[model samples]
Target chain A: MNREIVLSAFDIHRSYGSADASIQVLRGADITIKIGEVVAVTGPSGSGKSTLLHALGLLERPDRGKVLICGENGWALSSRKRAELRNRKIGFVFQFHHLLEEFTLKENVMMPCLIAGESSEEASGKADRLLERVGIIHRASHFPSRVSGGEKQRAAIARAIIMKPDIVLADEPTGNLDADTSAGVEKLIMELAEEGSRSFLLATHSQDLASAVHRRFSLGSGVLREVK
Target chain B: MKQKLLWALARRHVWSDANSTVVRMVSALSIAGVAIGVAALVILQAFMGGFTEAVATGLTAMNPPLHIYLPGGGHMDDFDLGAVQSIASEIPGITRVEGVLEKPAVVSGAPGTVSGAMVRGGNNAGLTIGMDLARELGVTAGDEIRIASTAGVEISGMGRVLVDTIVALAVDSVADFGLEEYNSSLVILPLNTARDIFRAHGELTSLGAFVEKGTDPVEASELLNSALYREYAGGGWPVYMSCIPFLAFHGNLFKALGLERAAMTIVLALITVVALLNLSSALTMIAMEHRRDIGVMRAMGLPPSGVFRISILRGFLLGGSGAVTGLAFSWISIFTINRYFPIKLDGTVYWIDVLPGVFPVTTALVVTLLTILVCLAVSTFPAFSALSRSPSEALRYE
Candidate 1:
């Protein structure tokens, strides 16, 4: 049976700098994500993998073409509406863990729920449950500065899926971790994706991570092509 | 919900130790600057307000509220004291009206101790001289002083001659009127004696009307003038009667005081503005330092407006803290000075023996609100500058 499409991007184009000195980053990068699908985009450094993830996640507006999250055209919406869409339906996990250092691990995980207007009690409860699921419940009260790299990454994963988004876009999710920690984070991501029928699109350089995903795509010279 | 979220984020940013040492130091300095500015403004305004009140009380206490007289210094030969008293009684604020004959006189006490004085003769018995006049004449309350009125003149055997109407009267009491002009040259005596000395019987220079406390003297004067005109309509009186409020007597002095108050307020407000500029700089530094955190918030779906609100709230927190601290400081300072260490002044020179500090509540409220408004206004530029960068741009380096 075919799963429902959760996120899709068609012929997306993006560039940097002014017109005279602009360098195009993404050109005709197409992607489609279905529920319960763990997909990886494999590329060399500066190959526009992060750019494609940013466009698909609605974090950046594409210069041309369309990005649809749950059938709503994200770029076509107003900036506020696009933010609402991103908050409600899309989650992001960056390579650096990107947890606010001022907050505890549990508070970091509860941030999205709080942003969605959930009460503190409700958000706290959900955050604890997610922390337990990610196998970092013991470190839930620790600040990001005090946590290990692998534990920080687990908290980041918990935060990304706390809102129960249709898709999670991770750019180099475990790029800074050791081999054992990277494998642990990869196992946690795969387990979470399967448990909740959640889709994940990861931009990574690790062939091991790419091979673990259900599908893989290689981006080169501003173009993305699927590798079976 | 959104406001709560914004407040939470702004509050965390303010209390967070994640900021650089330079940023924290700058923030503390900004708060201190605002506190000093607000304290200075409150204390200065309180003291100035107290001084103005003291001056007003001194002037009003020595003089009657309303002075009813004829135009051009013309005396009323047929001045009916009973009729004017009856009319004044009918007015709500007018407590009493007394006929007065005032004239410049040359007074001498002891040998060659002579000075020019304004002799005001009313119904009060005995001769009352100001402290300064008593000192100058070398006379005590019981010493006799000789006076010759400038208005007293007579036709003698020689054509068109001045009359020497010198009469010696013992000083009843020496008093201080709290003003240099009054204390140095004022003398008070009985109406009958003044009439005999000036040789002008049944004549009154003006009708002095006293009003009840808390009554507006100017409005009462206007009401009295209207009533007097209505009573003396159609040539009932020889000339038109006019009422002058006590404030009108020292209009220029009061106007100058008011202008000084306004100028002082503006000059002090500039200090607060300078402090707010420091606050603006501090907020800008915080925004720059927290760029990456702002990007993380944006990635979590916070809009540009949310970022702006967070910055504004941060400014408000800082400004409000400073304002409150300043107000508390001023209150303590004023209370301590007033209660334990009052600043003494020379009564003869400054009128009052002690300089007073009166806290003005309305002024404090206005200053606090304006400071907060300025904080919000100054934070906007930095907030918008933060907004100019996209989330991806902010997160690019991280």
Candidate 2:
């Protein structure tokens, strides 16, 4: 199994509003993430961090420049193709531990594999292993609304990694947690990247979460610069 | 693998999870509505068809398939009975032919007067009274009636070709018919009497024949035409064929019955449609209430189409279930009543017994198809309702 670069966002810019009222969210933000490297993005408020991650994730198209995932020109692809990549290659985690409230944790984790056309038996097995790995195995049968905050967050992480994707892009992964739970989540995120050799780009405002990663970059005024 | 997952998610969304069990209930209702509507429609159609067939039988029973009329200027002497019989035998389904004389007679009953009745005189064996006219005239079997006509040659003051009119004394009775249209005074006498009353002796006014059982009417008619051409044309009398099949002869009566059933179906089907509306909202609300689940499903990588498919299935299921239940109920009730319950009509009032409910398959099929189509349409809106929110938008809120 030969692994190569997973996702690359070339000098990208995104803007909104017409003419004079225009606002640039990301300008000339570039990042090429390898197959298994974990990259942490940290910035202050309104620093265009989430926007830059969105471009790299292919969820949002940049007004200029191209995005490539697994050597396919993602920017030029159809919306359906983009969705396919999002389903098969990349995983997303947002703040508030956005686990679907109606589904059990097991159903939530098994979703990615199911979308990729894996058999139910196989997907469930994979989901079980992932939940057990993340220490939420006991809560897998419980709905998201029934689970505790920390448990929900852990489930979200398990869901992101269930597909064994090339890149996992997370926005404020531990922003909703207390100090102690935030530390636990950061530990989980670090372990996920190291053991699976999966690339990660986690946007955060937390000091400890950013520092734990191998490399950290800061976003400011529509640009990303390496800080460490 | 992805498609399977997407399909599962779609199924769940449409069929629903615990959080929005009410939506599932709604979908169930939708399926039931469609099923019932469809089944009812089919059953109704069958009954209508059966009724039409039954009525057509009675209408065309005594009425011949074709009537051969002598051209207006022709001589009655040229009618070769033997030649006409041979030609008719060559045509399939022409079982019987009779020479007929039609007369315009004023029927005077003690209770009523019916003027200008186109009295058709044939052998007493084949005459059917217009039952509708009988009810209008209030005459019945064994009743006495008088018929009068004037012939210019009967009195010596006129030329030999003209006779002064005189009253024709005839004992009349009520005509027997398969349908309710006949109760009036009609005189069905022998051909000799018909000829004598009309005063067209040896000058046959019309020649008629009946189609034999177990033969196609059109083929028989064609054969009859060929035979008639060979027989009568050489005899110097041109006889033209009048084609009046059972359907063409009695179309109006059948149409009236059909329109009644159709109106009943339309009015009844609306009830199911209302039920389906509740079903659609229930399904859509289920989708909405389960928004987070949908988001979770999308995160699992199920596509939008999967979402659409599942919801529609749920709606159909609901409608179908209800429809079957309703249809089952209707079937038992109708069957029991039609078989065991005898509704007879008074001879003086209604032409027959109770109006029958016939269950035919073709009508049922058409109705079922329509019901399914309507259910499908209702489901479309609800199926797509939850899908508009993308995985991000859905998950972002949660």
Candidate 3:
């Protein structure tokens, strides 16, 4: 295979309300992503950056568009199939990590695999390996409440990759962390993308973070412009 | 595959979290409420069933379903000692017939103004009494007592001679009958004594018959009624008809409790509703608390139906546990009360000595069904809220 595109959104249109009070979130957005390619989306606030990320991640369906992931029509898919796609192919690491407060770090890391219907032993085994790779294995037993911010984000990253998703979607993943923790999480994110054989689509406000990725797309004036 | 995973995740969340525990606890309480209400109903209802059964069986065992006492009327023409016996024998289920004459009499320590006494003529030399009334009134067997009845007493106003002749006889048995109305007044004597002293000539006052076991009164009563009708026509006698079992013993005590039972069941079921409401609130709180986790599960491909199913399962689990606890409690209480302090009506008259409690298997099954229903109904609201929860909204809060 010649590294075919795993995610593509064509002329996507999304509006929040009826015609009179309508607030359009995505206006004819288009993007195609390939395997083993790290893509970063950078933009100022309110540029529909997160909305675009969500639409592409199968978390949000556009009002008008054909969203194809792994060459399957996702925008027209049933809620069941859409959810299946989200679970198996795409992993999300949010700005706040969004780790469940009640679960231990190990359980948190195993969430994606668990949701993918993997057995506890198998999920746990994968989660353990990922936690070790992300350097959060020592704190696997600690609940998210007890873990440090950096450790929590690492666990989130480990969780995102537990099922070995084809693509990782991170939106401002380091926004809530201090510089040192941000650097630590950034290293883990890069390591996950490389060692886990997964592509990353990162959306953030930091120029430094964008510069570190293999490619960057800056969202401005309702469009994604590739920046080499 | 996704549903199983979601359920596993949901179960873990349910098992390992305080909010989840509270949710399930509320459900358990609802189930318990159901179980408690149902068990209480079963226990209480069974008491009635047992009581009515004991009463009916006890009464039926002694004679026919009922005893027909012809107070003033002379002996039934077709109801000869042999005629009554023959009619009864003609029917397959008619077991025994004992023809007897009962008369009221006076046995007084004083003249004229005499205490009450009854002179009954039959083979029955000994009779029992209810314990409570016996203890209340101080009278015993072998004691000289007074009995009086104007069985043939004539009313001066109506010019009617409706009173059966009254006489007294030496009574037997201790003051064991608890009924105040029957205590120390019954005088058992021979038929000749009853007829001669009470002025009952060839006129018989009553005919009693016992029916075979396992024979329903309706069928036997119909059969007996036909035979009596035929006998009346053949002998040219005026025989007014009334079935004893139908008249005297219909287990009206249980019938009387019908409204009370329905009202109690409705009232107690309200407790289950309240518990269900409590469960709903608890489940709602839990659902809200786990919004982000639910979002995660949704993201992990859990269908909305799966979420709803898991909520229902949790409710059922809680309800089942509560039902077990409540059923245990009710069973203990009912079994204990029925076992030790059994209500014993006077056997001689009412046909039973000890009140009985019957636990039917149907009752247990019904309680379980009601528990599940109440719990699951309450759980749906929270599950709906969970289904509508958005991953974006949940993660925003997160």
Candidate 4:
């Protein structure tokens, strides 16, 4: 509770239609994540968990609310500035490992650093180190199409964290993997959170995964509530 | 710095998995489209330009290089023939100068073939008729001809004196003047005979200056004009003289041809625009196919501007390479067509026996750059539109 807040969403409201036929997705959802903490957001199908996560990640703007990262208000910043902040301060893992099929796994992992204007040599070096840490260094040269789902997810995670962001957002990171693979990914996520000062905000349906986090929340009917 | 990163990313995307069948096929189709457009434009433009040049050359061959005429819209009789001849002879490029007495006359052949002709002084004594005129008059070499100048009837103090002098001369071979109008109305005689018939002693209609082979007629004409102006400045001039370059006589023809070339270039450029549109479509598909990857990049902190640049770079590669290839193909086609496979044309109709092709460097450069710019513009529209969507919108489902 006394830990430093790395990322926080305050009264986020979002909808997905016109005023006459609107489907309210995230109506005043709020959460604060501290450094090195793992917080999980859980909900049933179509329960606006992804909407809340997207708004916090600055991937989409809320109808009315603010997303703050490291004390900077994302809503107040221009889109360009928000993107820069996202690149420098936030990491993202998706339900499906969205590795660029044209690039090799190493290049995919090195993308964030590359996007941040780092030299290829520097980006590649960091990518190699992260790939080895994630135990996927041997598959670095293989393209995404040639990799397994688990390997692809690992590479995505490496890319997400490559910029050394302050917070990481995972939306069903292990959703497409098998039981053993999901367990492996969950272990990796736990290990990454333990070893660094980075905070983790996870939106998942897996109670087992959510139980391992420091705090958990259930989002339903556009409302967020703390759960034991 | 950001551009370097985006460029690197774009380059990788283009080359990576380039061996894919769809990618290879699209790239090939795009390049071929551009090549065909460029080659077609080059050949068509060259043909137009070459035709004009050939017509100019043919006309130049037929007309005297430098013609000195009275500016006051009358015969050259008022010009001091001796002084004009002297100045013409002093001109450096002028190979020779001829004094001609030209008048409208009625010519009758022994076969009873009569034609209205402009009888002009020539170097030979026997009469020379243009080929068309000979054909019309039914006259050939060795035929006796009589010429009468009706223009000689002057209203003098001796009350309507007809200084009608008829000359009898044998017909020589026909001359080819390249123009049907001139060839059909031409009759040539000795200088003394023309002067006696016209009854204007020591009076010449115009002085024609022939330049050396390979000399530019316009430059020679300019030199002659300046010299003539200097003469007028020095003393009393008999009349105002105008030095006309041979090309001036057919100025309207060249002007019409130039206008046609410009209109043709603009029309044919549509082909290149079509090719660029193909390039635009290719980029659009690529942007669509890469939507997920774009989302990933956006998640990593790439701004929409970065996304925009990446899309534009992809278009540039496709369009730039295609244009270059097209231009290269055009150059080769022009050289081959001009060198070994010249298209034949009828000299009577087109004024040249063969169609000529010339590849102007400036035109090629302009066309290629324009195609590239067009490709960029088309690509930019789709890219900005697609990239304008939020990353969440693009990645919503997956």
In order, the B-chain TM-scores come to 0.80, 0.61, 0.69, 0.66
* Fraction of native contacts (fnat) of each candidate: 0.57, 0.37, 0.53, 0.76
Tens digits of per-residue lDDT, candidate 1, A27-136, equal 88888889889999999999988889888887777899898899998888988887788888989999998888778999999988888788999999999999999899
Interface RMSD of each: 1.6, 3.2, 2.6, 2.0
Q: Lowest-lDDT window of 10 residues in candidate 4 chain B?
A: B12-21
Q: For model 2, what TM-score is found for chain B?
A: 0.61
Tell me chain A's TM-score in each of the predictions.
Answer: 0.96, 0.95, 0.94, 0.97
Report lDDT per candidate.
0.85, 0.68, 0.68, 0.82
Expressed as tens digits, the lDDT of each residue in B1-398 for candidate 2 is 44444445545555645445665666666656655665566556655665566566655665566656544534343245455666777665678777766666666554656554556666565333455555555555455555555432454555354443344443444555665543243445566655666676775656666776777766776676666666557677665544334355456866788789779878767866776676667666765666655555554455667667766765565555556665665567567767897445564554444556676655554555555566668778867665665554555443
Error of 3 at B395 (Å): 4.2
lDDT of 4 by residue, A163-191 (tens): 88999999999988999999999999999
Candidate 3: regions farther than 4 A off: A1-3, B2-17, B20-63, B66-94, B100-129, B132-214, B226-239, B244-255, B318-324, B335-364, B388-398
lDDT accuracy of residue A146 in candidate 2: 83
Clashing pairs in 4: none
Question: Candidate 1 DockQ score?
Answer: 0.53
Measured against the true two-chain complex, the DockQ scores of the candidates, in the order shown, are 0.53, 0.26, 0.45, 0.46
Candidate 3 lDDT at A64 equals: 85
Which prediction has the highest lDDT against the true structure? 1
Which consecutive 10 residues in model 3 chain B have the weakest lDDT in total?
A: B128-137
Higher-ranked by DockQ: 1 or 2: 1
Task: Show model 1 residue runs off by greater than 4 Å.
Answer: A1-3, B74-95, B101-205, B212-214, B226-233, B236-241
